[model samples]
Target: MTIELYTWGTPNGKKASIMLEECGLDYSVHPIDITKDEQFGAEFLAVAPNNKIPGIRDTDTGLTLMESGAILLYLADKAGKLMPTDGEERWRATEWLMWQMGGFGPMLGQAHHFHRFNKGKADYAEERFLKETQRLYGVLDKRLEGREAIAGSYSVADVATWPWAARFEWHGVDLDQFPNVKRWYLAIAERPAVQRGYSVPSAQDIPMP
Candidate 1:
């Protein structure tokens, strides 16, 4: 059975879509326009009580899942790919995944919120978040040094972090400054599946209400 993916075009949503594409899973997308408050709708809330994008309903297991990181891990396990089953490699992949979920993602999100979305300039907040975002990017850049992918391979860690990193410019990141990350980013961006996944839910398909 095909998976039912509830998502949008944002980074979190792209995570699920990319994972599905990477896993070669058959799935259908249900676009959720969070900007229009569609995520809070009773129907969407049934599958995602948290009222967040990137939820999924796996018909094969009759399981409903939320949180982009969890969803990626679940899909990786379900497919028996994109993640090591056990060993240091497995833990390594998981470690970076957590780092992304707990640190990189949230920090960059706040940076984008303050720097781009804020109507009234919040100078202090913008500066704080942007600096933190840069720090996190620096960490990622160092980790990518002498490596092609996070956790040493293209695993769920890569899948989870790729979407957010793709918006580096929006987060005030200079690709030239983080050459290693830029290389990794460009490599991932060239994947056909990643390309298709990033294009999920065309902007014309979901109008803000």
Candidate 2:
């Protein structure tokens, strides 16, 4: 069951690689260099119509998938791990995963664009995204209080969120301000699979907050 993981070093891309490592699945990496606009090439588009960095083709099932969140769910189902089988726990895990897909990742991306990469070019965009980023962090911190993982027990929720939180510095986030999130982020950082996955297709140190 070798999965061909099409990805880069971004957070969303890391999610697929990290889950692959966690599932102990045999896989190969195909680096889609978004930096050089290779994702837009027709060949890559055949796998991921959205032209996204992280996509996958499961050789055993002949399934090609796009979108990091969808890929996570599919891999969990295929491996029968990370995701809960039933009950409130399952829904709770799904909720947090959705939260990451909707708010955490997208907002932080905008914050990174405005606050970090293009600072002063659009002050209003910067301020709006940065403020939203802080609010989202506060929400996550509160959810993490007295909890080890985002959805109780390490699951897809944690896998989805941790990579985004790993980029705290890029979005002007001070993990110190969100102690619970900081603790959660650090705890996940220590996982051997996470350490391996964070450097998928290339080697890069996980940024310490």
Candidate 3:
């Protein structure tokens, strides 16, 4: 059986879609336009009580999973390719995923909120998020200094964090200051699958603004 993926075009939603494509999994993408409040509807909220995109249902396992981190783990387990099976390697993968959830996710999310989504003078919010984001970027840069792909392998950890780091330019975070991170982000961003995942939606759905 196939998986049903309910998601939109945002970063969190794209995480699952990219994983699906990378794993060569058979799935359906349901575009939920958050601007029109589709994610808050009854049906969507049922699968995702928090009414968020990136929730998926596995027909084979009869499991409904939400959150990008959780979905990545589920798909990794299903694919048996990008995830480690035992020992410290497995824990390391899990640690990086948690880093995304706890560090990158929150910091970048707040940056987006204040920079793009703010309607008023939310200077404090913007500054706070940007500072936190920079700190997190430093941590990532240090981690990637002598390594490749977060955990020495191109696993879900890199996949999970790449989008967040990629958004730094959009959020006014200087990439030049962090050479290692810039290299890592650009390398992942240049991949064919990453390019394909970013182009999932049709031209008509794209906003002129």
Candidate 4:
């Protein structure tokens, strides 16, 4: 089945593409240029009412989905790969994925906005987000202290979280400071599927810490 992947070149967008690549799924990429307000177009709105990047239509199942977290889980189940099958490992994977969704991604996005894009516009916002960004990184570092992957193996949690961490520079994060996280990030970065997915809809080098 050919999946229709509607997305832009953003962290969230890369999540779906990365999962697709990892699953060895056949898919077509339809670039939605959010910078040009293309996401608001009626066609995309039909697929993603939230007007966000990284929505997909699975021709095999005729299932349309939005939200990066949900998409990762769906693809994992469909592929029967990149996720734990049962018990605590599955829930652990889900937990870390939600951690990325709830805290890491949003906080890092704010860090990008206040610290990178709109620097000097708001000192308080910059400091606040940056502090939170570092805190979240510490949490990740601790979680990764003795693990190769977030949950256990190379699962959807890694797929969901790695793209955001790829933008560590934008968040002004020095991966060197979070040693465990740096190690985990670098290892995941070396994956062939991750390298392929990171460039979906366009080609861009993955940033090194």
Candidate 5:
């Protein structure tokens, strides 16, 4: 059986699709066009109460799930691939993944909204988001100072946060300060799986920028 992923091109949505691709899971992508408010429609709302993208229905198990983090964890558990088997390593990866879900995703999402999508340039909004975005980048940078991936492995935790790091410039957050993140970002972004995963929701281009 195959998994069906309803997703958009946003960071959170990309996280799940990237994981599915990296795991070599057979799946289909149903692009939920946020611009057209497809997520708010009845069909999507049935799959996800929050009417959000990045949801899945597992035909093999008859389990339907929402929220990117939950979906990532579920997929990881199902595949037993990206997550660590050891208690300590698994906990470490989970903690960082939660950090990305709670801290990084929200802050950077707001930064993108205020900095790029909002009407007019709001200095206060920019300052607020940039400060938090920079702080979050610093946190990740320190965590990755000498590491190759988050939790010392290229797991779901790393995939979950990769898109945000790649899109830092859009949030007015500089990459030079987070050299370690930059290194990891370059490595992951260049991966064949990541390339394919990141391309699913893109109807035209695969975000070369």
Candidate 6:
């Protein structure tokens, strides 16, 4: 049975779609136009109480889920792929996932909002978030100094964070400044499943705010 994916094409939304694609899961995409406030509708709120895009309902198990990080982990476990089964490797993956959820994604999101979308400059907010975003990029670069993937493997941690890094230009990031992240980002971008996932809901479906 196919999962019903309620999502848009933004970073968080792309995480779920990318994980599903990587797991070879059958799914149907339903675009949630956040720009039009579709995410706040009661129907969507039933499954995603936080009124966020990237929720999913699993037809095979009647399970509904929200939060991109949690969804990625669930899909990874279900597929028996992408995550380490036990011990240090497993915790390591979780550590990076939390790092993305708590810091990277949120900082970049604020940078995007203030730098690109805000009506006025909002100087303080813009600078604060952008600086933080760049700092987080540097952190990732240091972690990837000699590694191909975060957590030492292409696991859900990568799935959770790559989309955000992929939008470096939008966040005013120069990949050259973070060469390791640039290398890792380019490597993941070449994956066919990632390419497909990044295009989910289609470009035309994304509405302007």
**Which lDDT value does model 4 have at 8?**
88
Query: Residue-wise lDDT of candidate 5 within 1-209, one digit each (tens)?
Result: 47989999888888888899888899988889999999998878877889877889999987899999899888988988899987888999999999998999998888888888883579898888878988998899899988999898888889889977768668765576678877888888788888888877783233333
Better of 3 and 5 by lDDT: 5
State model 5's lDDT: 0.85
Off by over 4 Å in 1: 203-209
In model 4, the runs with Cα more than 4 Å from the true position are none
Q: What clash count does candidate 4 reach? A: 0
Between candidates 1 and 2, which one is better according to lDDT? Answer: 2
Clashes of each: 0, 0, 0, 0, 0, 0
Residue 37 accuracy (lDDT) in model 4: 98
Tens digits of per-residue lDDT, candidate 1, 73-188, equal 88998888899988998999999999999998888899889998992588999989988999998999999999998998799999889888878768878878988988888888
lDDT score for residue 29 of model 6: 90
Candidates' C-alpha lDDT: 0.88, 0.94, 0.79, 0.92, 0.85, 0.89
**True-vs-predicted CA distance for residue 37, candidate 5, Å:** 0.7
lDDT of 3 by residue, 1-209 (tens): 48888888777876787788778888877778898999899878877888888788898988888888989999998988788888887888889989998988877898888877882578888888878888898899999998878887888898888866656765677788888987888787767767666555322121111
Q: Write the per-residue lDDT of candidate 6 for residues 12-87, one digit (tens) a residue.
A: 9999988999999999998999999999999899889999888999998889999999899889888898999999
Given candidate 2, what's the lDDT at residue 143?
98
Candidate 3 local distance difference test against the native: 0.79
TM-score of each: 0.95, 0.98, 0.91, 0.98, 0.94, 0.95
Model 4, span 59-99: residue lDDT tens: 99788999999999988888889899999999999999999
Clashes of 1: 0
Error of 6 at 80 (Å): 0.8
Segments in model 5 whose C-alpha atoms lie over 4 Å from true places? 119-122, 203-209
Candidates 4 and 5, the one with greater lDDT: 4
TM-score of 3: 0.91
